[model samples]
Target chain A: EAGVTQFPSHSVIEKGQTVTLRCDPISGHDNLYWYRRVMGKEIKFLLHFVKESKQDESGMPNNRFLAERTGGTYSTLKVQPAELEDSGVYFCASSQVRIVSTEAFFGQGTRLTVV
Target chain B: TQLLEQSPQFLSIQEGENLTVYCNSSSVFSSLQWYRQEPGEGPVLLVTVVTGGEVKKLKRLTFQFGDARKDSSLHITAAQTGDTGLYLCAGALTGSARQLTFGSGTQLTVLP
Candidate 1:
């Protein structure tokens, strides 16, 4: 009955360094989503996974960002050689349905600061 | 790209006052949702309106979806200090139901 959970509530790293964020969705949830909110911007979708398969990743910012969901249990988002602009709050959400109308449980989020 | 615009980017009012926040978009959506986010936390779903012209209420909060399915509103009556938070509106487009287009958010602070 726990909500979605994310690791490293906060992170600070030098520019050009790599950081990985992890998300564990609620038990038995099949749909997991990644989102980011840059400074002064609204939260934007980064990608979505359905049972270990990426259903849509069109929102991924660039090749520098990589997201994987292995075994359909958890997800990881890696930003390699991150740029200063990559500093933002990354959020993870999960739901039992693929439709957007369904309620999605969200995590506390991981705030990444690229200095 | 589809974008949603929220009015009164910031709002501060004394407790017991009524306030309304609007979310407008040019594109139509299959559904629209409103959320409240606190510091250090992600957004929490407040309500979801799937049909045009639908209105739903939760306690002192009332949510309405536009007839065109391109706009929505949230109204809180007799607000309390606990009502203070960042209010966000997101829409799932008719074609791309997997992604949500979000508004910049309206920061509401209700002082007691």
Candidate 2:
């Protein structure tokens, strides 16, 4: 089966611009997650979607960032008025369930650069 | 906030050498997972250890979960150039959301 896939492998935008990253999860997977890694930093969770509903979004950095998984198949993360700090690699992952120890499959990631 | 601390921040070793990386935390987790990420790629799950004191081996790679469930270690035997990448450790806490808390990561470079 094909693994999770992300769109626009690399994106470069000017400061204050808007950017949207997309992710397509594996077939029959119900758990989708968004994460990002800033320069020289660890990957951080942004939010999680279980089916079409968001299960957790506490890791969202600010109001400028928004994520949605409509119909529970794919997900999109949008950053409005993107700042320099928003430049980083955005990753998407999916799993079959939220069990205690299930493995999550990750996409290659979308690298965003704000100049 | 739950935090997973990984040590050695970076490692550069010659091929056929052995190395070990550690992940520690003060908080107990119900399960922990290790991942390997190459440049321009997302992290790929390596293994998940759910039980305390559990040891799982994948070829030359061995993973051990702490008896207290607060730490874990990864040992790579006779490392090769293929093992060069970033290793990350993540934890899933009990009663919390299913999201994972990831460690800073250890960047490994194996010289050929």
Question: Which regions of candidate 1 are displaced past 4 Å?
Answer: A98-102
> On residues A1-115, what C-alpha lDDT tens digit does candidate 2 reach at each position?
8999999899999999999999999999999999998998888889989999999999999999999999889999999999999999999999986455457889999999999
Clashes of each: 0, 0
Q: Per-residue lDDT of A9-57 in model 1, one digit per residue for the tens? A: 9999999999999999999998899999999888999998989999899
- For every model in order, the fraction of real contacts preserved is 0.65, 0.76
Instruction: Please compute and give the TM-score of the first chain of candidate 1 against the native first chain.
Output: 0.96
Candidate 2 predicts chain B with a TM-score of 0.97
lDDT of 1 by residue, B6-67 (tens): 98799999999999999998899899899999999999999989989999999999999999
Per-candidate DockQ vs. reference: 0.69, 0.74
DockQ of 2: 0.74
Candidate 1 residue B96 C-alpha distance from true site, Å: 0.7
Runs in model 2 deviating more than 4 A are: A98-102
lDDT of 1 at B66: 100
